[model samples]
Target: MSESYRVVEPQTGVRIGFGDVWQRRELLGMLFQRQIAARYRQMLLGVVWLALEPMAQLAMLTIVFGFLLRVDTGGYPYPLFAFSAMTGWWLFSKTLMSVAGSLQDNIGLISKVYFPRLILPLAATMKELFDGGVMVVILVGLSMLYGYLPTAKIVVLVPLFAYAALIGLGVGLWIATVMVRFRDVRPMMGLVLQAGMYATPIVYPATLVPERFAYAYQFNPMYWVVELSRWALMDKPVDIAPPFFWSLGFVCVTVYGGLMVFAKTEKIVVDVQ
Candidate 1:
């Protein structure tokens, strides 16, 4: 008599693995929809809030930097200069802030689910993208209002925006993973964002950053992304090579580290809940 051996098959449903995430794309879409709906639900201004927030910031910066500090905007109106930078910075900061708390806030689902934890942070990013689209409309209006219509260089914005989003996603993933283990990360992130607004070349042009510190300032990826937005929209000359490479390297390191950390700690995520 021949002995028979049993073969075990790996589980096939959605799980933490990368291949599983690709298979569960529908679930990611659903999560994105849920985030958008929740963000706008029961709000009087709804989507208008997106435009208003940036507009208010632009107005304030125009007054403080343009009128008070007497900053030069490369001859473009201060509102245009400030709005362009705010467009990219707002997307990065808002996406990072929302995603950092996603894991803890969605613990109820994480404990019960077999989906990729990365999905939570990624879905939060989509909400920022939706708001960013609204900001683009406002930008177009402001461009025409200031008589600074974009030239063919505006076509560069597509790739620049993609770079901006990837930077946010990579950093958001890293922060979200860390926040799960260190609850203090969230508040520290708020402080970082506040400091970043001042450190970045948002309210003023890169020319005003002083020649000696320009190299050091390039270490901040948002500085490049913000400059890219202004260059794309305003046709200004920008040093894209250094920051672009730095952003690419930073994204790779942060995303890989985030995924590994998340995979290792996810096993205990439910226990903490």
Candidate 2:
């Protein structure tokens, strides 16, 4: 009698791994729909909550940063200036949290499934597209109200959205792989996000950082995203300097590295969970 053995290998090539994801695009779409349904199944306001949540947050931010601290906004209306950055930041932060928790949240299904593990995070990312679309409308409306009418530069937001998602997915993939072994990493990420918001120039302008420390601040990936977003949305100034290039290189390294790490460890995650 002769027997044959089956072998499975890690997806080491970024292109190969993503190609697998593409091949399973239908499964990805199904998961995206399931996620959306599950999220709003019983909520009273349903998808409208997506719009409400940000507006409520913007109101509080306007009071705290715009009123209490009286942060300078470089002559633009504070709401427009802050919301422009907030739109991108929200996409990044929510994607990170959603993707990071995806594997754990669906551990039961993951234990039984033989699909591309990347699908869960990618599905989680889909809802953010809806949320982002809503935010963009609000942003445009706010911009016009503030006399910062739409410009051709606004088109840059298309890639900027993808850039923000890439950053989140990169970091989330690393965390998702780790959290299967160390659940503590999940909560730690929340603290990191909270701290990260203050570190990035969102509610406050970049100028608030003293000129001496400006170079170091450029190390922040979102700093580039926010500045570029403001420039695109409101014609604010942006410096595409050495630091911007460094952060861009760092982001590229991060996303590719995260994919490699996730592919290496994905099989083991089920065993640990």
Q: What's the C-alpha lDDT at position 110 in model 2?
A: 85
Query: What stretches of model 1 exceed 4 Å from their correct place?
Result: 1-16, 241-243
Report the lDDT tens digits of candidate 2 across residue range 1-273: 499686777645443278779999999998888877877887858668888888898989999999899899988888887899999999999998888888899888889978888888888888777677778888889899988889999899889888998898888888888888899998789889989998999989988899999999989999988998899988998868899889999999988888777777777778888
lDDT against the true structure, per candidate, is 0.77, 0.86
C-alpha lDDT (0 to 100) for residue 123 of candidate 1: 80
